[model samples]
Target: MTRLMDQEQENLWDSVQILSQINAEKAKAVFKVTIEKSLQQLGITVPVFSTIRLSVPSTDRLSQLRQIEKKMREAYAHQEKEKAYEYLVDYIERLSQMTEDDPLVVRKKLLASLLNERYKRKPKWSAKRYRLSASLSPLLSKQVAAAYYTTSEVAKKLGLSDQTIRRMCEKGKFPGAYKTDGGHWRIPRKIFITTPEQDERAEEALQQIDIKNQKAGYVDEFDL
Candidate 1:
């Protein structure tokens, strides 16, 4: 959280990002009360985060092919197998360079082949010893939790200036979000909802906020 302020970035901490997958309902309720009061005093709204469409950079064929391979690894790590398969198919298609004639059945087999390589190797790896070194021990350090997105990231995505996002955040437009002592906004990703409904947009963002709070892990928090 401090890192966000240090870099003059947008950093939001909401129920989902805070609790991740922990099911301490009682604790959540208590924290909710405290957080609401804090937000009210700060004049920042909840859902400080919001979705904006960001521009994609130009990619040559070689880079695009590398991205497909990297995406396969990412989707699999996120446990998004369906997406992983899609990436796998994309990889094979690039290899074949024959998208016009390839069939889905063939692509499916290629995807399976990709998965099989990992599945077969999984059992062969030996477990490594785990230890907490003195320098890395919890007693000597304060661990600050985090999510991947930042204020700069959101601005880049929305194709707007960071100052605009920061201004919106400061105006109490996004509830469950707050400005830090240094004036940077701490925003959760759920705050981004691009619906045309004037009144329902906040409502939709709030619903997502609740859903993410109930779930564990940041990997699937957005579901966007």
Candidate 2:
């Protein structure tokens, strides 16, 4: 009977040790993931420290993109539409060269679409602008085009005057509202007139994009 009890005690101790080891391993994995995510947010990738080596190249590309986007925003703030458009063209050209299957390419394409929309109603819309917008259209999904509403379109939709819509947008009544270089307001359709089904679809789309982005070794959190 004493031998039997000793054997049972040994088995219990072994199980306890196994459980403790598993918990420790899990904690280490969680810590590594947390560190990796924090570094990614800062646009830093240390391949030697991370198991996700594939992310290093993409992260470098994203850093380059962020610099270009910064220049574009600066140009926009200074009311230099032409300069901003030039930067946008450069940005899209770089994204086009990346593999189409890349999730980053899709996200960047949507951003490029938004930037392209800003110049659509330019008073001095040039042939160059038209060509650039046209070339970029094929690269973007139709959903991106459907996501924004022009000031006049919103006015018509809400049965309000265009001036009223612009005033509301400027007063922060509209979420995701942005002014174009031509001083026109563009509103996000999702925030303005989306039905529950539309909202669900949009959420699902974003979740799918997130999943694909994760598989691609990065998460997209940057905006123009």
Q: Model 1 — which ten-residue stretch has the worst lDDT? A: 48-57
Q: Give the Cα error of residue 133 in candidate 1, in Å.
A: 24
* TM-scores, each model vs. reference: 0.23, 0.29
130, model 1: CA deviation in Å?
30
lDDT of 2 by residue, 1-224 (tens): 22342343333223223222334332223223333222222222232232111121243554565467556655665788788768766654554443334545554544544444433453554323322233466655254446667878765443346887787777766645666445667666544323334334433443444465467643333110
Each candidate's lDDT (Cα)? Answer: 0.40, 0.44
What lDDT tens digits, residue by residue, belong to model 1 across residues 1-224?
22333222111223323333332332233223322322222232233111211111123543565456556655665788788767755665653442223445444544454354334443343211112234455643223113213467556444346886677667754434454444456555443322223224323444455676578445354452
> Candidate 2: where are CA atoms >4 Å away?
1-57, 98-224
Candidate 2: deviation at residue 96, Å? Answer: 2.4
Best by TM-score: 2
TM-score of model 1 vs. true structure: 0.23
* Model 1 spans with C-alpha error above 4 angstroms: 1-145, 193-224
